[model samples]
Target chain A: MGNIFRFIARYHLFLLFAVFQSVALVLTFSNRSYHRSWFWNTTQEGTATILEAYTAAEEYVHLRKTNRALAEENARLRGLVEDSKYIGTVKRGGRKDTLQQYTYTAAHVINISFHKRNNYITIDRGFLHGIKPGQGVICPTGVVGVVNQVSRHYSSVIPLLHSRTRLSGSMSKTKHFGSVIWQGGNHRRAQMLDVPRQANIQLGDWVVSDTRSAMFPSGLRIGKVAAFSLDPESQSYVVDVRLSVDFASLQMVYVIDNLLKKEQVRLEESSAQEPE
Target chain B: MRHPLSALLWSIVALFFQVFVLGNVQLFGYLNPYLYPIIFILWPLSWNRATGLIVAFLMGFTIDFFEHSGGLQASAATLLFMIRPWIVRAVAPRSEMESMPLTLQAMGQPKFLTYTGMSLLIFHLWLFWWEAFDFFELFSILFRSILSAGVATVLVYTIQLFSLKSE
Candidate 1:
C-alpha cells in the first residue's frame, strides 16, 4: 500500500544501515565460527596479487634479516646432512628399510597479521603448489601455523597466535602433554592447559609438539615454559610459554604434508566404529 | 560539491592507502592509524543519506576483503556513516551551515578536528572491540581507540592540507 511506501521512504536510511550492519555481522560471526566466505579472504586472486606486490616492494627492507635467518637455518640443515653423522645406532642384521612419512614444501609469506585476536597469515603457495587445509606449517626455527583455506595460487594460515588455534604440546623433559592456546593479548606468549600437577616441570623447559597429533612432526619446538602455577579448580598447572617463532618478522616457512595422514585417519575411524 | 565521480575517486584512493600502506603500520603492536574514515567525514552534506550508507558499506567490505578480516570493518564503517551527520551538525558553526562540503578548510581546524576525531574514535572502538572480542581486554581496547584516533586524525588532517588549494 501507499502507507508502507511512505514508511519506507521516511526511514530508508535507517533501514539501509540496519541491513548493511546485519550483512556485516553475518560475515563476521560466520567467519568467527570458521565458515569463512571464500571470496572475502586474501586468497581472492586480486587481493593476493596486491599483497604480493606490496610484499615485493617491502622485501628489501627485510632482506638483511631474512638473509640472517636463512643463514642460521641453512647451518642447522647442514648439520643434518648424511656426511655430518656417523652410524650412531648400528642396525643389527635385518632387512634394510626406510620410511618417508612427511614432505616439506617451501613457501614465501606474502602477508601476515599478528596484532589481531583472530590473525591469519597468507602464503604464496596454494592448492596448485600442493598446499591444503589442515596441513601444518613451520619456519626455519619453529612451528608457525596450519593451513586454513587454499586458493589456486595462495592460501591462508591460522597462525599459532590466533585465539582459535589449539596446538597439542608437551613438556620436552617430562613428556607431560598439554594443550597450547593463545589467550589473545601478547603475540609472543601462549598458555598450556591441563598439565598435571605431579609432572616434573621447570622454568625454561622446552615445550614441543606432541606426537599424538598427526598434523605436526613429533618434537618440533613450539616454545619454552615461562611461568607456571597450580590451578585451584582443575588441580592442574597452567603454564605460560614464550612462543619460539617471532611472527612479526617471519618471511619463509615450509608446509608439512603428512603422507600417512589419510591412512591414520581411516584406521582411527575404522577402530572407533568397532563396539567398545 | 556533491560530485559522485569525485566521491568515487576519493573512495578508491582512501581504500588503496588504507589497505596497502597504513595496514603495515602498527605502533606498539596495537595502535593502527586508520585514514579511510575521512571519506565519510568529508562527504558532501547534500549527498543522499542512502547513497552514503551504501558507499560506506561497500568501502568497508573492500577493506575487510584485503585485511582478511570478515565484517568488522564493514559494520564499523556503516555505524560511522550513520553517526556522521550528527557529528558534523554538532561541531559546525551556524554560519558554516550553508557550505555543503565538510572540509577542513571550510570548517576551520578546531571544528574539523573535533568532528573527524570523534568519528575516528568511535570507528576504531567498534573495530578493535569486535577484533579483540574474545579477549575482553577493555583497557587495551580503550587505549587503542584513543591512540589510533589521534594518529588517524593527524594523518587525515595532513592529507586535507596537501589537497587544499592556497588562495
Candidate 2:
C-alpha cells in the first residue's frame, strides 16, 4: 500500500544499510572456514592478477635476499643428494625397488598476506602444475604452509601464521608431540600446546613436523622453542616457538606432492566410517 | 563541492593507492594503516543519503575484494556510512554541513580533525573487532583497534595536510 511505500521511503537508507551489512556479515563469517567463496578470495582472477603484478614490481627490491635463500636451498639439496647416494651404496645388498614417497615442485610466490588472522599465500603453480589442496609447502629454512585451494594457474596456501592453521610438531630431541598454532599477534612466533610436563623439553630445542601429519613429511623443521610455561589446568607445557621461515620475505617455495596421500586418505576414511 | 567526475577520479586514484601501496605496508606486524575509508569521509555532504550509502558499500566491497579479506572492509565502511550523517550533524558546523565537502580544505583544521578522527575511530574499531570476532579477546581487539586507528588517523591527517597545501 501507499503507507508501506511511504515508510520505506522514509527509512530506505537504514534499510539499505541493514541489507548490505547482512550480506557483508554473511560473507565475512562464512568464509572463515577452510572453504571460502571465490569472489572475496585472492584466487579470483582480477585480484590475483593485480597482486601478481604488484609482487613482480616489488620483487626486484628483494632479489638479493631471494638469491641468498635459493643458494642456501641449493646447497642443502646437494648435501641431501650426497647423503642419499651414501645410503644407497651402504644398503646395496638390501636395496629392493624403493617407491618414491614424495615429489617436490618449485613454485613462485605471487602474493601473500600475513597481517590477517587467517592469512593466505598464492603461488604460480596450480592444478595444471600438479598442485592439489592439502599438499605441503616448504622453503629453505622450514615448512611454509599447506595448499588450501587451487585454480587452473594459481593456488592459495594457508600459511602457518594463520590462526586456523595447526600442525603436529614434536621436539627434535625427545620426540614429544605438540600442536603448533599461531596466536594471531606475531608472524615470527607460534605456540606449541599439549606438550606434557613429563617430557624433558629444553629451551632452544628444535621443533619439527611429526610423523602423524599426512600432509607433511616427518622431520621437516618448524621452529625452535623460545619460551615455555606449565598450564595449571591441563598439566601440559605451553611453549612459544620462533619460526625459521621469514614469512615476510618469502618468495620461492617447493610444493610437496605426496604420492601416497590419496591412499592414506582413503584408508583413514575407511577406518573412520562406522559399520553399515 | 567539485564535479562528480572529479570526485570519481579521485576515488579511483585513492582506491589504486590503497590496493597497491598502503595495503602492503604493515608496520610493527599488526599495524596496518587503512586510508581508503577517507573516501567515505570526504564524500560531499550534500549528496543524497541513499546514494552515499550505496557508494560506500560499493567502495568498501571493491577494497574488500582486492584485500581478499572476505567483506570485512565492506562491513566496517558500511557501518561508517550508516553513522556518518549523525556524526556530521553532531560535530560539523551547521553552515559547513549544508554546503561543502567534508574535506580539511572545506572545514577548518579543528573541525576536520574531530570529524575525521571520530569517523576513522568508528571504522577501525568495527574493522578490528569484527576481524577478531570473539568476545574473549576484547582486550586484544581494543588494543589493536586503538593502535591501528591512531596510525590510520595520522595518515589521513597527513594526506589532508598535503592536499590542503597543494590546493
Candidate 3:
C-alpha cells in the first residue's frame, strides 16, 4: 500500500490529467443523444436564470419583430376560436369524442445555439410547467425542436438544427413522407432523405409533419423544398429544404402535449412485441 | 507572473465572455471563435500542474453548461492543459524558459504568438473533430478548426497584448 502511494505521488500530475480528461470525455459521449447529467446543462436553474436574464435584457431590440409575430399568431388563433365554429346540428343522445389528442403550452426561449455542431435550445418552461422529454416544440411559423431533458423550471430542447435531430416530414401536395435531418452547416436549411424518386417534388413545394410522428401534430409545416437530386446509391431523392422557422430570430414557441401519446405508444409496443 | 487570485479572476472573466459574447458570434454561419482556451493558454507556468488541470476542467465544464454542449469543450480544454508544458518547451528557448518568466513580455511578441497560435490550432482541431465525432467530414472539420483557431488566436493575442500594456 505504501509502494502504491509512492507510485501515485510520483505520477500524480499525469493521473490527475487522465482522471479529468476521462470524466469530461465520458460526459461528452454518454450524453450525445440527450442530457443525462442533470446539473451540468442549461436546464439547471442557475444557468437558466442567467440565460433568462440575458434574454430579457436582449429582448428589447427584437420587441417590434416579436410583437408582430405574436399579433399574427393571435389573429390566426382568433379565427379558430369556439364562436367561429358554426353548429350545424345538435345531437344530444350520441356519445361525442371530445378529448383532444394534442395540446399546446406557450414558452419563451431563453438560450439557443443554431451554429454548433450539435445545437440545443433552452426554454423557460420545465417539468413544473408540464414540459417533458420527447414533446415537440413549434413556433407560429413551423417546427422548432423536441424537448430532450427537463428540470424544475427549464428544459433543454434538441433543436432541428442539431445533427441528431430527425423529424418525420411529408410532402404537402403528394403526402409522400421522408425524414428531415440537419447536416450541420446552415441553420436555415435541412435535408429530407429517403424520399421516393417517383414522388412529384418541385421547387418551393411545402413539407409538413407526417401523420405517423407522435411528437408533432399532422400538417405542421416543416420546410419547403429548396433543391433536390437523385441519390444513385440509395435510389431515393435527397431534397434540400429551406426551413420555415428562422432559428436565429426565434424566441416564442409552444410545447406540444400529446395527450393520447402514452396510449398510442403502449398499443404499438404491445403489438410489436407479439409474434409476426 | 500573475497572482493566483488574479489568475482566477481572469479565468472567470474569460469564461463569462466566452459563454455570453463569443458563444453568440459565429462568423459565416459556422465558425465560432472559442476564446475560453485563452484561460488555459495564459496559465501561470510556475503553478502546480494538478491545480492547472483542475482549473481547466472546471472552466471547460462551466462553458459547456452555458452552451449546453455536453463535455465537448471540457475534454478539449483538459487535453490542451495536459500537452501545454511540452508545447511551451517546444516553442521557447530552453535557457530563457528556465531563467525568465514565461509571459508575453519575457518571450517577446513573435515567439509568444507562435506558441499561442500553435496551441490554439491543435486545441481547436481536437475540439471540432470530436464535435463531428466522425472522420467522414474530415475537410469540414479541418476547415472549421483552422478558421476558428485563427480568429481565436488573434482575439486572445490582442487581449494578452492589451493586458501586458496595462501592467
Winner by TM-score: 3
lDDT per residue for candidate 2 within A186-271, as digits (tens), equals 88999999998987889999999865768788888999999999999999999999999888899999999889888988888898
lDDT of 3 by residue, A3-55 (tens): 99999999998898888878878777878454655444444788889889999
Rank order (by lDDT, best first): 3, 1, 2
lDDT of 1 by residue, B1-167 (tens): 25889889989999998887788765666667789988888888777888888899999998887777778899999999999878877887666665557888877889888998999999999988888774567888888789899999998898888879553
Show pairs that collide, candidate 3.
Answer: none
Model 2: TM-score for chain B: 0.91
Instruction: Score candidate 1 by DockQ.
Output: 0.59
Q: What does the lDDT read for residue A53 in candidate 2? A: 83
- Runs of candidate 1 with Cα error greater than 4 angstroms are A32-43, A81-91, A267-276, B90-100, B161-167
Off by over 4 Å in 2: A32-43, A82-92, A274-276, B93-96
Candidate 1 interface RMSD, angstroms, 1 decimal: 1.7
* Lowest-sum lDDT 10-residue window in model 3 chain B: B93-102
For each of the candidates, what fraction of the native contacts does it recover? Answer: 0.63, 0.63, 0.71
How many Å off is the CA of A112 in candidate 3?
A: 0.9
lDDT of 1 at A25: 83
lDDT of 1: 0.85
Q: Candidate 2: deviation at residue A135, Å?
A: 1.7
Model 2 scores a TM of 0.92
Interface RMSD values for all candidates = 1.7, 1.7, 1.4
Top DockQ hit: 3
